[model samples]
Structures are given as structure tokens and as C-alpha cells.
Target: MRKYIIILISVIIIAFGGFYMKHQYDKKEAELQYFNQAKEKMENYLHENYKNIKEINFSDSYSINPMGGISVEGYLNGNKAKEFYGIYDKSNDEIGVSSVDAEEKSE
Candidate 1:
């Protein structure tokens, strides 16, 4: 009887551990998806609006806004000192740029 109880507890623990791991994995996956989408949206926005920008690099950290959108900070043309902020609005599938200091290139 004691052996059976031990086995039962062990099984329960393993099941719960598996469930927790799965939940964590799903959460991370969702976060990664959001990050990728936000990065892509920001890149597209910059390319369309800023003709001189040839390269884009985003920071590793981001924030979640009150409206459930993702906000990120990045720099253009390999200049890390000059940073720009952008937000990806999930509901409207739009990206808004703010505090950009990138100058337009002469044609």
C-alpha cells in the first residue's frame, strides 16, 4: 500500500511538472511571436518613411503598453547613439514612430 501511494504521488508530480513546463513554453512562444511582429512592423515603417535608412537594429528589451501593444527602441544605419521609439498596435495592425532623429539623405 505504501509503495502504491509513493508511486501515485510521483506520477502526480511528474504530470504537474510537465504541465507547468508546457505553459511556460507556450507563453514564451507567444512573446516571441509578438516581438517578431513588432520588429517587422517597425522595420517596414522606417523603410517606407525614411529613405536614407539602409539598416535597422532593435534593442533586446521591449515593453507592453496599456493597450496590449508592444513598444520597442531601435537605431538606424548602425548608429546606436541615435535611437528611435516605436509601438506596434496589435488591434489596428499599425506601427507608430516617435522621437526619431534620423535625417533624410540628399538625392
Candidate 2:
């Protein structure tokens, strides 16, 4: 009876280990696909703005998990978009011309 219990326990552990490894494999595959997609998107954006963009990044070391940092999206916090700081300066004045010219006057 003792030997049977030990065998059953070992079998359960092996089963759990296999399941855990499979889960990790699936997670890695998902991460790779996500990064590939993000890379394609970044390339598309850069190509669209090739004339305007100076530099660009496709991905970072941030994890795709919900309990992690920013990657494609900013954050999952239930906060609405808020303006950090903004100040506008506008100048309006009458147009003026310089008092100097290349044309010569008969003195």
C-alpha cells in the first residue's frame, strides 16, 4: 500500500510538471507571435512616416502580462486621458517693412 501511494504521488508530480512545461511553451509561443506582430506594425508606421520620423522602436523588454509595464498600450488603470501640461503662445502684430532698399534715388 505504501509503495502504491508513493507511485501515485510520483505520477501526479510528473503530470503536473508536464502541464507546467506545456503552459510555459505556449506562453513563449504567444509572446513570440505578439512581438512579431508588433514589429510588423512598427515597420508599417515607420514606412508610412519615413519622411517625418527620425527614429523608431519596434519592441522593448516589457512583458505582455497584465501586471506589467507599458508596451503597445499605456496602462490598464481605469483613468481617463488627462493633459499633463500645455501652454500656447500667439503673437499678432501689423506687418512692417525694412527701411533699407537696393534701389537708388536721384540726389
Candidate 3:
């Protein structure tokens, strides 16, 4: 009886471990997709507001906050320009640019 209980407990533990790992994999995939969408939106915004966008640069790090907000740093034509911050709605895969400022930093 004791051996049977131990085996059952082990099986339960393994099942939970598998579930947790799958959850993490799904989360990371979703985050990557969201990042790509955010980057694309930034590029579109830059093209509309600035000329010669080929020279633009952007910081490597983009913060996605717990509240689904995205903050990105970008330079226009090789010089520091407005920063972007907004919320990403997963239901629509859209980023809403809340504000663009020249000196804003990620929190």
C-alpha cells in the first residue's frame, strides 16, 4: 500500500511538471509574437513622421510590463528622438501608442 501511494504521488508530480513547462513555452511564444508586432508598429510610425528612416536606430531592449504596456527606445536618423510607450491588447494583437516623448525612459 505504501509503495502504491508513493508511485501515485510521483506520477502526479510528473504530470504537474509537464504542465508547468508547457505553460512556460506558450508564454514565451506569445511574448515573442507581441514583441514583433510592437516593433513593426514602431517602424510604421517612424516612416510616417520622418524621412530617410534607413539611418534610424533602436535600443535592443524593449520592456513589456505586467500590465501589457510596451516601452521602446528609438533614434531617428542616427540621433535620439521620441521614445514610445503604449499598451498591447492581445485580443487584437495591437499596440496603442499612448505617448511619444524625446526624453522618456523605461520604468
Candidate 4:
């Protein structure tokens, strides 16, 4: 009985581990796809518009929980990549799209 239990437990562990890994892979794949699309759009917009192209805005991090009263999907503006975005409000932090701090560009 002990041997049988050990085998069963091992099988369960392997199954759960595979499921978790697959879940993680799917999540990462989705994020990568979203970033690719967003980057293309931003590049197109900058190339076509933004005459002089001083800066651009992108979203860095975001979340929306209606039940928790939490919302964060702010904006970012910058002339180059690796921008540092900070704000007074907590609900204003993005990663991929709104990572530009538009205010800084005006100056």
C-alpha cells in the first residue's frame, strides 16, 4: 500500500507540475504577442506622425479590479527607450504602452 501511495503521489506531482509550466508558458506567450503588436503600432505612429518626433508615450504597467477599487493604466512620454516614469497617484503605472512621460517632452 505504501508503494502504491508513493507512486500515485509521484504521478500527481508530475501532472500538476506540467500543468503549471504550461500555464506559465501560455501567459508568457500572450504577453509577448501583446508587446509585439503594441511596439509596431507605436513605431508606425512615430514614423508617420509626431513631426520632429521629440517623444512618445507608452503604457508600462496596468491593472483593473472593479471590485477592489484599484485601477492603474497611466501614461509615459519620452524620446528614448528605458524611460523612468513616476507619478503622485498609485493608479498610474504602466509598462509596455503608456511608459512615456508626456509632460517631460513639453519642456
Candidate 5:
């Protein structure tokens, strides 16, 4: 009976662990998808509005704050540019461009 109880508890713990892991993965995946969508929108907006800029580039730098705010860094026409894209809402396809900054290009 003692051995059986230990085995049962082990199985239950493993099952709970698996469930928690899966839940975490799903949450992260959703956040990733939202970030991608926001990035795409920002790219499109830059291309259309910032016509003089030859290239709008994204770097490896990215961050997600505790409140789920996202920030991404990149380059604009060879100058460093960073943008803060606020929380994403699927129902509202419009992405709010919170802030954007670009270093002046030097001759």
C-alpha cells in the first residue's frame, strides 16, 4: 500500500507538471504571434510613411515587459531606430505606435 501511494503521487505530480508546461507554452506562443503581427504592421507603416528610408531593419533586440508591453529595436536607413509597440489586441487590428526614434544619418 505504501509503494502504491508513492507511485500514484508521482504520476499525479508528473501529470500536473506536464499540464503546467503546456499551458506556459501556449501562453508564450500566443504572445509571440501577437508580437509578430505588431511587427508586420509597424513594417508596413514605416514603408508607406517613411519613404526616404531605404531599409527598415529589425535587430535581435526585443523585450516584453511585465505588463505585456513590447519594444523592438532596428535600423532605419543605416541609422539605429527603436520602436515601442504597445499591447496588441486582435479585435483591433490597428497597431498603436507608441514611440519611434531614429539616429540621424551622417555624411
Candidate 6:
């Protein structure tokens, strides 16, 4: 019957919509986890290596790089004008500081 067909189509639509929303939610949660991990690694590195760092601040935006690491940017000691960059490698559970010049901010 026509009514049965209409109901079937509506159910299909609802199922697809629910799946799409769930996918988006999962993606956002993964990104947030990565961001948090990166931030924590950077914080620990700074604390262990530096003495004058009182506070750490990170930008709201982060990206997963092609090299399978997360790149983060932030500033230290509430100095938002200066930039602090860090790369966190998930595989080794380490922060990559070789490319980052934490002592000097680029103009």
C-alpha cells in the first residue's frame, strides 16, 4: 500500500540521519582527546625543562598532521602575543620539540 511505502521511506531517512549525527559526534570526541593529550605532553615537557614557566595556554584550534601527530600552538605565562608550538607523536607518546623554538616567538 502507499501508506506502508511512505512509512518505510520515513524510517530509512531517520536511520540515516541518526547515523550521520553519531559519526560527527564521534569525530569531534576523537579530536578533543587528541587535543588534550597533546596539551598534557607539552605541559609536562615545559615543566621538566624550564624553570620560569608559571602558566601555559593553548589555542582552541589543533590539527592532525600527515605524519600521524597532532600539532598544537599556544603561549606560556599568559603571554598570548607570543606563540608556542608543539608536535605530539601518538605512537611514541612523546612531544617533538626539535622543530619548535619555544624560547623565541616568530614575528
Worst 10 residues of 6 by lDDT: 98-107
Considering only N, C-alpha and C atoms within 3 Å, which residue pairs clash in candidate 2? none
Give the range of the ten consecutive residues with the poorest summed lDDT in model 3: 98-107
Q: Residue 50 lDDT in model 3?
A: 46
- Report clash pairs, candidate 5: none
Output the worst ten-in-a-row residue range by lDDT, candidate 1. Answer: 97-106
Question: Which residue segments of model 3 deviate by more than 4 Å?
Answer: 55-60, 74-107
Best by lDDT: 1
lDDT of 3: 0.65
Off by over 4 Å in 4: 52-107
lDDT of 4: 0.46
lDDT of 1 by residue, 24-105 (tens): 9999899889989998988877776666787888998988878788997888889888788988898889886466668754
For every model shown, what is its TM-score relative to the native structure?
0.87, 0.52, 0.65, 0.51, 0.70, 0.84
1-107 per-residue lDDT for model 5 (tens digits): 99999999999999999999999999889877767876777676565544465666766555666655565556666665343333333455644444455433343
Cα lDDT over the full model 6: 0.81
Q: What lDDT would each prediction earn against the true structure?
A: 0.84, 0.41, 0.65, 0.46, 0.63, 0.81
- How accurate locally is residue 61 in candidate 4, as Cα lDDT from 0 to 100? 58
lDDT for each residue of candidate 4 in 1-107, tens digit (9 for 90 to 100)? 99999999999999999999999999877755555454545545343433354444555553323422222222324445434332222233222223332333231
Better of 2 and 3 by TM-score: 3
Better of 2 and 3 by lDDT: 3
Compared with the true structure, the alpha-carbon lDDT of candidate 2 equals: 0.41
Q: Tell me how far the alpha carbon of residue 22 in candidate 6 is from the true structure, in angstroms, after superposition.
A: 0.6
Query: Which residue runs of candidate 6 sit more than 4 Å off their true CA positions?
Result: 97-107
Q: Can you give the lDDT of residue 64 in candidate 4?
A: 29
